[model samples]
Target: MSLTDQLMTDMKVAMKGHDKVGLSVIRMLKSALMNKKIEVGHDLTTTEEQQVVVSQMKQQKDSLVEFQNGHRDDLVAQTKEQMAVLDKYMPQQLSESAIRQLVQQTATDIGAESKADFGKLMKAVMAKTKSQADGSVVNQIVKEVLS
Candidate 1:
């Protein structure tokens, strides 16, 4: 099923089960998807949908960290739950070692030799990795390999 269809199905189930957090997260995701569609004036492709989910997951993780830092356990828990819901839609993330290896290999493959070539290397790496790896991790790996 498409992510939207799966989300609709889960939302219905949540409604039937009176699952507050589940329902809320589904609604938030749906809203984000719809907004993307509106913003682009076109339906999202499979890749676009995945990108949206990844972006939302990243935002949720950031929020969770801020909440924890502020001593807002309730918000932190809520954000964590939302992240869990979103993660169901994302592919399993690559491990740190795997990401590092991919970054090094990509830089090598593209003949990226220094910090000046980082932009080129990053473009190639992101094209290959997409949502499977975090950008921050990829950047660190690229920097390490180049240095």
Candidate 2:
């Protein structure tokens, strides 16, 4: 099933099971996806749908950090639950070792030997990994590999 269909199915199950957190997260995801479709004025491809989920996950990560830093334990727990819900929609993430390997291989393929080639290396690795790898982790690995 497409992401939307999956969300719809999950939404109904959440409602029936009285899963408030899951229902809220699914509704938020549906809203984001709908907004993206309206913005593009066309049906979203599978890649586009994944991008939306990744974007949502990124926001949740940022919120999670802020909540932790602010010592809001209650909010932190809630955010973590939201993130858990979002996780179900994401593609399997790349391990750090896998990302490092990809960075090395891509750097070799692109002949990126110096830090100056950081942009090129990063673009290539991210293109290959798509939404599977976190950009910050990839960035750190790219810098380590290039330097």
Candidate 3:
């Protein structure tokens, strides 16, 4: 089944199991998936669905950072739970060493020898690495490799 379908199924199970937090997060995810479908006036491809899931995961990561900074351990824990749920739906994430290797290859493939070529190299690298690695982490890797 597709990611969206799996999410819908899990939503039902969460509700039946009386999992409040899980239900809420799954509901929000379903709503986001539906919204994208509505925007495009059609169902999303697996890639599009993955993109939406990844976007939600990114938001949770940001929220976790803010919640921790604000000393809201409760919120931080909640966000972390949601993030873990989100991660299960994603493909295997690249290790740091793998990402660094990809960054180097991407730079070489694009002939990016200097900082001026950073943008070009990053575009290609992110195309391959998106959803597998965080943007900020990817950016730092690109900078280090290119520098």
Candidate 4:
């Protein structure tokens, strides 16, 4: 099933099971997906759908950090729960080792040997990994590999 379909199914289950957190997360994601589709004026591809989920996850992470730094334990716990719900929609994340290896291979393939080639190397690796890898982690690995 497509992400929307899956969300719809999960939404119904959440409602039936009285899972407030799960239901809220599902609705938020569904809304974001709908907004993206409207903005693009076309149906979203699988990659686009994944991008929306990733974007939502990033927002949640940022909120999580803020809550933690502000010492809002209650908010922190709630944000963590929301993040967990969001995680279910994401593609399997790449391990750091896997990402490091990919960075090395991509750098070799692109002949990127210096910091100047960082952009090229990053672009190539991200394309290969798609939504599977976090950009920040990939960025760190790319810098380490290039330097």
Residue pairs whose backbone atoms clash in candidate 3: none
Off by over 4 Å in 2: none
lDDT for each residue of candidate 3 in 1-147, tens digit (9 for 90 to 100): 988778879988988999887888888888998999999999898878878888898899889889999999999988888877777777667899999999998887889999999899889998998677778889999999888
- The TM-score values for the models, in the order shown, are 0.91, 0.96, 0.91, 0.95
Can you write out model 2's per-residue Cα lDDT over 21-62, one digit (the tens) per residue?
A: 999999999999999999999999998999899999999999
Ranking of candidates on TM-score, top first = 2, 4, 3, 1
CA RMSD (A), model 3: 1.4
- Which rank order by lDDT, best down to worst? 2, 4, 1, 3
RMSD of 1: 1.5
Against the true structure, candidate 1 reaches a TM-score of 0.91
- What is each predicted model's overall lDDT from 0 to 1? 0.88, 0.96, 0.86, 0.96
Return the top candidate by TM-score: 2
Candidate 4 whole-model C-alpha lDDT, 0 to 1:
0.96
What local lDDT score does residue 144 receive in model 1, on the 0 to 100 scale?
86
Off by over 4 Å in 3: none
Q: Give the TM-score of candidate 4.
A: 0.95
Give one digit per residue, the lDDT tens place, for model 4 in 1-147.
Answer: 999999999999999999999999999999999999999999999999999999999999999999999999999999999999999999889899999998999898889999999999999999999898899999999999999
Task: Give the per-residue lDDT of model 1 (tens digit) for 1-147.
Answer: 899999999999999999898898889889999999999999899888888888898899889889999999999888888888778888678899998888888877889898999899988988998788889888888888888
